[model samples]
Structures are given as structure tokens and as C-alpha cells.
Target chain A: MKQSLFEIVSNIQIAENVFKMVLSGDTEAVKKPGQFVNIKIEDGGLFLRRPISVCDCENAGGSGKGTLTIIYKVVGKGTEKMSRMKSGTLDILSGLGNGYDTSLSGEKPLLIGGGVGVPPLYMLAKKLISEGKKVSVILGFNKKSEIFFEDEFKRLGASVKTVTVDGSYGLRGYVTDAMPKDAEGKDGYTYFYTCGPEPMLKAVYKASKTAGQFSFEERMGCGFGACMGCSCRTITGSKRICKEGPVMEKEEILWED
Target chain B: MGRLSVDLCGIELENPIIPASGTFGYGYEFAELYDINILGTFSFKGTTKEERFGNPTPRIAECTAGMINAVGLQNPGVEKVISEELPKLSRCFNKKVMANVSGFSVDDYAYTCERLDSCDQIGWFEVNVSCPNVHGGGMSFGTDPNAAADVTKAVKRVTKKPVIMKLSPNVTDIVSIAKACEDSGADGISLINTLLGMRIDLRTKKPVIANKMGGFSGRAIFPVALRMVYQVSDAVKIPVIGMGGVSSAEDVIEMMLAGASAVEIGAANLVEPYICRDIIEKLPEIMDKYKIDTLKGIIGGAK
Candidate 1:
């Protein structure tokens, strides 16, 4: 992870405690599907590092070595403090966690995510389109207030579908509820990929017919695997959420009720 | 400009700003971000005899200027570190690495040090006696004068390496603990691991950390950290590595003036990922502004 003090091009509060921060840094190591950046919020104010989903990666690893984006909700003090920070500069540890595994994703694939979890899905959707793959995304949020990144995904040419819990927008229900009922019928979907809360992840695992990958959101310490502070039990054994995955295969997930 | 170096025991460091353990992983990770050669020496993660999974969730919490951690010395075991981690580290960080060894008991510390004695890449042995975050090992061995002495003496017996015993700040008498380890044959002393701290979830009526209690560090504790370091330095004649909530080069100046020969940037590393390098680069600029010519002049100059 490159800990660079990136100038904030823009930082906006999308929801109450949720914010979207765009920064300039080494975006080259961030080309993959499920990668994340560990954000150090409020200089040295917040002790623990906060991990946010990579909304998109720009400039890859070129000379400019350009921009990085992350969207997060104020789950606690870290994000709450981050929201108060107006546009200026950010000292950040970016390019953390093993993102998504794109090799298993076929030409025609399905992506699903909910709420703040939708951040990384945006990057994954764009990647699939770049690979000349037919990508479809199902996104869910609590309500219209929680919705984010619709037009951007559309601009990427990924067939994007939206869902909400309050019947406020798109398909009125959860993302799983919006899963093409004909998923088993005709569409040639090679694999499934998803991220969100544990509940949404469980739904994605249960609803998908084909094998998929899930990005698990966990409170982290080092944000690297060395701490073993973010390990979640899987079928194989205990795996570090930051290392083995914030992204893990659907088959390996051990859903905790 | 003289020897930009420090001799901790017989082991020579090109400089004095070693990256504190836990904050700096095996050095390769940070080396990938920037050149590790710029550093004096980096302390590796605390390695126990057996593999340690570390503490539970909510291991870190941010306070005013610093953060607290309950990482519980999570490591991949001593054998794995010597075999796997060390080789990877050798390729990246050209500087000597002080192996910060932590254990639950005195024997544990000795065993791990004995294992590390064979590796020449290890420039020194930093016995982790000051961790307030862990349940049994940290301040438990550091706070008690007798235990601290016993643990230091045991490790010194096993190896010829210069052993620097890290002293905790959570005790009633910080000087006593530092003096205890020094009297027991420690080559040097590192002061002020995070102080004991606690935070509450007012909304939930529970503690914020899963561990209920954690170690506090950062800008908030600099004054307290300086005081302890000053006291410990006066109490003992050994070289001291002082750190609390050091974030900038100014803090480094203050620490050295207070009597630390070197300083470790702990919570600052968590805050600014490039702090290890940032501080090193900033030190020269800071030194220039203050009309300082030698790195040695700043130590113990406070009136």
C-alpha cells in the first residue's frame, strides 16, 4: 500500500454520514475487480485505519499514476470525522486488500451489491465492459437517499439495474429480489460477483445459480493481513478478510446466519 | 554529517530512526511504497515462538492526536519469520533490522531470541516489554520491576546480541521499570508504549473496543511521553528510543532534546503511511531551520 498524501480533487457527503472522496495517487496497482484502499482519516486524529471500497481506478500505473476514488458511510468515529473534513489534502494508505478475482468471470456475467457495498461494484462493472464482456449489475440501497453511482455505470455501458428496500427507486425490493427470475432459463451468465453487508452477501450467495465471489466488509486493524484482525471463517479454514479476501469465492463463504 | 550513525551495543545503524514494530511490517511492504534504505533500521513485527492470530476486532481506536491498538502481537511464528519473512525482508530493506521479540513468559522471550541469534540480518534484539495492549505479556512484564529484570536477564543469557528492553508508560513508576531492565543487563531501553486507555459507545452503553481496554498513543500523549522519557533517561545511562504520538519532525526534535537518542513513529505510521520516510526527509529540513549541524546535538539539551 502506497501511503501518499494525495490532494483531494473533490470530497462530497452523499448521505448523512456517507461520503465520496476522490484523491490523486498510485492508481496503477488498482486495475483488478475487488481491490480496496485503506484510508487514514483525519490525519492522526482517528487511530484505527478505515477501509473503503474502490469506486473506480483511473490512469492505472502510468506517469501521471493518477486518481483513486472511495465511497463510505459514517459507520463510526472514523467516517464521521472524515465527513467533517472539507476539500484539502489526505494522507492515505491506498491499494489494500485482494480485490475481486476476474478470471472466473465469463464474458457474460452478473454483479450485485447493496448500499455502500455498491462502491467496488462500480469498478468491477467498468472492468468487465473494458474486457469486452457483457456485464449486468444489480444494485440495492436502503432508499433513494442511499443510492449512488447510477449514471457512471450507465456511461460504462454495463447494463445496470437498481433496487431499493423502500420501493423508492428502480425495482422495488432487495437486489436478490431483482435477480432475473429467468436466471436459470436463457441468459448465459458464466459467474456471479457481489459485495455489501453480510445480509446482502448471504442473499447473493443463495440467489446466484452459478458460482460467484463476495467481498466481505470488516472492521480492520492493520488493513493488511499481518494483523489477522480481520479474519473471517471460511469452509477451508480461517482466512484474513484483508488478505485471503475482502473478496472470497461464493463456494468458500461461511455465512454466519 | 559526521557518521549519520548510531552504535546500539556493538551493532551499528547508519541512522537512529528505526521504524517501530507492528507499525512497520516486514519492511518489504513499506519498501514497495518507498525505499527502505533511507531508514536507519526497521523493527520487524513482534514474533512469538508459535504463530499468533492477534487480538479480536476493533483492535484500533483513534483519539485526539493518536490511536490505540490491541493487536496482541499477531505474527506468523518465529520459525516462519526467520525462514520466510526474513528472506523477503533482506531483499528489500538494506538497513539492519531489529527483531522485536514478544512472548507470554520469560522463557518464551529467551527461546525466540536464541532462535534469532543465528541471523546476521538481525542488527539487534528489541525485547518487547512495553506493550500495554496485550493481556498477559505487555505491561505485565514491563511494569513489574522484578519480572522486567528477569525477562531481560533471561534473554541476555541466551544470545550475544545487544538487547534493548522496551519500557511501558502505564506503571506508577516509569524510571524504576527502565532502571530494572538496565540493571539486569539490557544494552538499551525504549520507552512509552501506548498508555492504558478506554473509550465508551455512549449510544450503546458499551465500550468502543471489543477488548474493552486499549493502549493510547499519538499527538495527545506527547507531553506525557516526553516527561516519561526524560525521567527514564535521567534514571538510567542507557540509550533510549522514545515514542508516544510523534507525527512530525518537530516532535522528533522534542523527543531527542528530552533525552531519546532515537524515536519510533507508532500511531503516526497508522495516520500517515509514509511517515517513516516523511519524517526522515523532514528531519534535515527541520535541522536546517533550527541551525542544527549535527544529529547528536539535539539529544538531552532541554534546560
Candidate 2:
């Protein structure tokens, strides 16, 4: 809801074509895990602001300034330009979209993410673990070289598992292949939360046995609710992915065939 | 400083800047950002006789200086708009709001407009003729002068408010359509709704937008919109509301010089949420820079 100039504290390539950036600014607007920030690229040709999720945020003491961490993959001209930026300020619109509802996550929670989607879940895992909840995380990537944030997730004291498609890394196949089972040898997760590309999201959605929340990605116009550009049909009705959610409950999601 | 007030079809406005429909979203969303009462008036999202889910996902494609959207007029139907949406809007906005209506047939337009006419807060009816006519072999109503006139005449009969025909830029003869609307009883005109455009993804080897084609608008389309506004304003005696790629206060003055009595900021609102407020604040300074005594003096000044 607030737009301010955020100074890039550091920007580094964490993995192949993937970057982790730390921004110093007024991070008060970012309230929850799945909410995103819209970065306006100063490049002459690029007019639309790029939306990236908040990986983590902390109020750096009582200086009234906080630091925001975001992870992005160099997908196109905007991200490519973002990758080249070394230092200086970025005009960022912070605190966008409805984040995940942690109240729904019961005693034992399962968190799933793929590739760049892993960033948002990092904050969610950290929050849930701090709440005295047993948290398990499954990180999905294409290969060993593309993997990121496993050690970071582990540092939060959550049981972390890494899955790769080519068998070049941890468990072979997708994140769905590495799901944990309960004491009865059934789907053990009390509740699940996920963020990733559509194919992987669908895979996790099909594999999950408990009530969960899914974070969706869409090509958005206004990273808020004004433009109905990013609306999707749910079981209840159509909702704006940028506003009503980047997160929706499992029962309401009506996946398009 | 000179006067900023404008009279559109006998209705007075505090200023000449109005947020275009689909971008403003009933005024409450932006009202959360800043006081929307500062605006002259805003056009709400396009409403239809029946509820429309709009097009499929991937409805937006970013361009060089603009973007293309195939949102397809997604709305909760006119009844829901009047019952649910307008009540919410009334709490935030005190000014009379423009109601933008779209439909598949003439009766559909009339039915929706007639319903909206009963709403106390509605100041004007912007009939979007860009919708494809269901009865006319799927041709867009705005592309044909006869159909555009027919829609204008039909909506005018049912509404007490001024009927401003919102025209599409996809047509070949823009002036003829504008003139036809004026002749058929359109009280005013708002020109250059998004231009028809598309973008393809090289990696996916398919159209970026699921609808394949969408209406394009942004700062990139400013010159084209100015030219169309100039042409249409000359052809009709009714007031012309120009929109397309208008972002700054300078662009507002330029649109007025090109013959628009007022201008709507469309895509720019998406880029910066507080853009309209920023532009309105910068206008007096820009007016001083250009040595313009009054905003109304510059309407059609270029012509």
C-alpha cells in the first residue's frame, strides 16, 4: 500500500539464473509471507513494474528502517535488467496481495515449493516453526545446479527435503514423489502450503491428502485488485490473484483443464 | 492560476482528469490509496446485463511502453453492480460517477443502462460499443457506423443521464462512427479505447495472451489517441473525452489541445497506484510552464 525508494543493499546470483537481493527501506507494509512487491524498472522501454514475492523481512532495530529480501529468476528483459543492477534505489510498491493464512496450519504442517517458488515458503516456514509447530519443507528443482535455499530452510530447524527431476541431486522426480507419510502410513501432513509453477503446483495438489493453501502466479497488470487482468475462476467465484490471493484454499481452487 | 472546472454534457466537474474504466474499479480500491474525491469522476469497470467471467487466464501481455489486456469486460452483472458495488463506492466517492456499460446486443445495452439510470450516484452512461454484436454476425458494434448509431439511440432513450459513446480504435473510419453517434443522440464522446494488438511468446511458441488478441493502451498510444481525439472532436459538436496512454499532467494538456475537454488516465494508474493524484497535483505547475491561463482555453487549440 506504500511506494518508496528502496536501496539495494546487495544483489547476488545464488544459483544459475537465480538471484537473491536484499533491499533496505520501510518494510512495514509487508505483513505476510505470500505478499509481493512491485519493482518499477527505471529502464526507458520497460513501463510495467515487475512483481516479486517477499522472501523475508526484518525491522533493522528501531531506526524506523527495515530490510526486505527477494528472490528472482532472470526470465525476461525486466528480470535481466534487475540482474544487472548493482547498487542504488529501486521504486518499489510494497505489501501487495493476500498472504497465506497460518491459522489453518495445524500441529504438523507441510510446506512445498519449486525453483523460485521456494523463496516465499522460506518466510512461511520460519514463521510456522517459530510458532512451536512441527514444520517439514520439500524443495523442488530441475537439477543440482539450479537448487537454492536448502541450508537456509534447515537453519530454521525444519525437516527439509530436496527433490530433483534428473536424479542429479536429492530424491529423484518432483516434490510430490518425496511427500512424507503419517504413523498409519497414510498422507501424514496435517496441512500443506505450496508455491511454484503451475505444473508443479498441480502435481503437489494431486498428491496432497490434507487441507492446504496454494500460492498462484499470474501475468498481472496492476499488482493490486483494480485491474481484473489476473482473475481466475475458483469454486466460489472468480478472484484476483494479486489482491484476493496469491494464496487460496484447496477446496476453493477450480483448476482449469 | 486558471480555472480547472469542466462541463461535460451540462454536468460540471471539479477538474478535467478522470480515471478510465477498468482501471479505477468502482473508486474504492484507489480510495484506500488516496482520497478519490480529489478526482473529477472515475468510470467504474465495464458492466454487462449478465455476469461475465471474462476471458481465460494469461489475459495480460506487457509491451514496450504499454500493455495489451484481453480481460473481456469481466463484471458481476448490472444488478450486482447497482446493489453491491455502487453501495460500496458511495461510501468513498461523493461525486457523481460514470457508469461504463457493455453488452452483446442492443437490448442488452438498453437493459443494463436502464437499470443503472435509476442509481442516484450515476452521472453519465459510457456505452462501450466495442463489444461484439451477438446478432450482427459477431462483428463489433463500434466498427460499423450503423450499429454504433443504433446502440447510441437505444441507450439514449432509456437513460436520463448523458450518454457518452465509448468508441474503439480498431475501426477504419473513426470519424464516421463518432459523427453517427452524435447524429443518433449521443450527448458526448470518449474516443480511442485500446487499439487491437497482440504479442507472442518466443519460448512457448504461442500467443502470450490466452485470448490471442487484446486491446492495447499506455503511454505508447498517446499520439494515436491525440490524433483520433482531434479528428473526432472536429467531426462532432458534443464534448470529447480523450484517453489512451495518458500518464502525466503534460499529456493532459496535450490531449486538451488535441480537442479533448477532459482526459482519462488508463494504463498509467496500473503502473503507479497514485498516478492520477500525482498528475492532478502537477497540473498547475505545468500550466504555468506552458503559459496557459485556463485549461478550457486549450481545448481544440491545436486545431
- Fnat per model, in the order shown: 0.45, 0.81
lDDT scores of the candidates, listed in order:
0.79, 0.90
lDDT per residue for candidate 1 within B160-272, as digits (tens), equals 87899987888899888888899999999987787889877778898777788888777799899999989988888888888887878888888888998888877666546
Query: What's the DockQ for every one of the candidates?
Result: 0.45, 0.87
Local accuracy of candidate 2 as per-residue lDDT tens digits, A24-71: 999878888888999999887898899999999896222469999999
lDDT of 1 by residue, A1-257 (tens): 55667778887987646788888766756656677877666553456667777887788545555988888887776777777776777766666778887778887889888888888988888777878888888889888888878777888898888988898888888898878765555654788888888888887777778888888877666676544556666798778787678889877877753
Q: What is the TM-score of chain B alone in each candidate?
A: 0.96, 0.97
In candidate 2, stretches whose alpha carbon ends up further than 4 angstroms from where it belongs are A60-63, A183-187, B131-139
Candidate with best lDDT: 2
Candidate 2 lDDT over residue span B214-282, tens digit each: 888898999999999999999899999999999899999999999999899999999899999998899
Candidate 1 chain B — worst ten consecutive residues by lDDT sum?
Answer: B1-10
Candidate 2: docking tier:
high
The CAPRI quality class of candidate 1 comes to acceptable
